[model samples]
Target: MLKKEAHYQEHHFLSSDYSKLMKDPQIDDAWQSDIDSLSPYLERLTMREQRWLIGHAIHDQPPHNIAAKYGVSTETVKGWRKNAIKKLRNM
Candidate 1:
């Protein structure tokens, strides 16, 4: 499902292989450092925000299904998810 793919992509981004790919001492050091620096910020998200992010990543569920789980309107769920990601990016 689309949601599953999204989840996989997120996990891939956080995986060791991805980290190792950034291991070039000269060229990739800065990139690697940047990802490392973001760890603390990522860790600071609220639990609900984190779950929503993971759900979004999986991309399996339609907005309506996600809304049902969260007891919100589909539009509201979409908005919350979008805002959550925007906040994460800003962090």
Candidate 2:
């Protein structure tokens, strides 16, 4: 598991960027639609899982760094990111 402080920092970083990106009307609409379409799959994820996916996607973080932050192996983070991409493609 990630340490509490690490998790808090990650969330803070992601939330700030998310807020800025969502202010763009074009990006915001597309993002909201994508989220709505993927709602079922997203709902199945835990809060931490959702945060990880969002953070990775929005920030374009490398798998290794994401794995370190999330306390998972790089392979595991890669798998989750791949799965998220697949889900988004289907949506």
Candidate 3:
């Protein structure tokens, strides 16, 4: 998950040397569509579960760090993530 969010955050006009691939409007639209599709599933998760997913996916925070912040074991954090993903999949 390291730098995965950073990759998504990169934009065409924001860079001095533009990425030709990101220049395509369809690529940007597809990315937005993917994000939009997750909204309903995300809404169904508990706040704790949502925080864990967003922290891992977008902030690149490791499970250990998230566990520490939430005062739970790393395994518990992992379990929460698994269950949250399962719920999202079932949705």
Q: By descending lDDT, how would the candidates be arranged? A: 3, 2, 1
Estimate the TM-score of every prediction: 0.43, 0.44, 0.54
lDDT of 1 by residue, 33-87 (tens): 5546554544544444444553455335677777787687888767767767787
Top candidate (lDDT):
3
Error of 1 at 46 (Å): 3.0
TM-score between candidate 2 and the true structure? 0.44
Model 2 per-residue lDDT tens digits across residues 1-91:
6699777764343544544544545345546765555445555443445545655665557888878876889887777766666655775
Model 2: lDDT of residue 83: 61
What does the lDDT read for residue 31 in candidate 2? 64
Model 2 spans > 4 angstroms off: 1-49
What does the lDDT read for residue 6 in candidate 1? Answer: 72
Residues 25-88, model 3: lDDT tens digits? 4335645455355556555665556657656764578999989977999998898798788887
Candidate 1 weakest ten by summed lDDT: 18-27
Runs with alpha carbons beyond 4 Å of true place in candidate 3: 1-38
Better of 2 and 3 by lDDT: 3
- Assess each prediction's global lDDT (C-alpha) against the native: 0.56, 0.59, 0.62
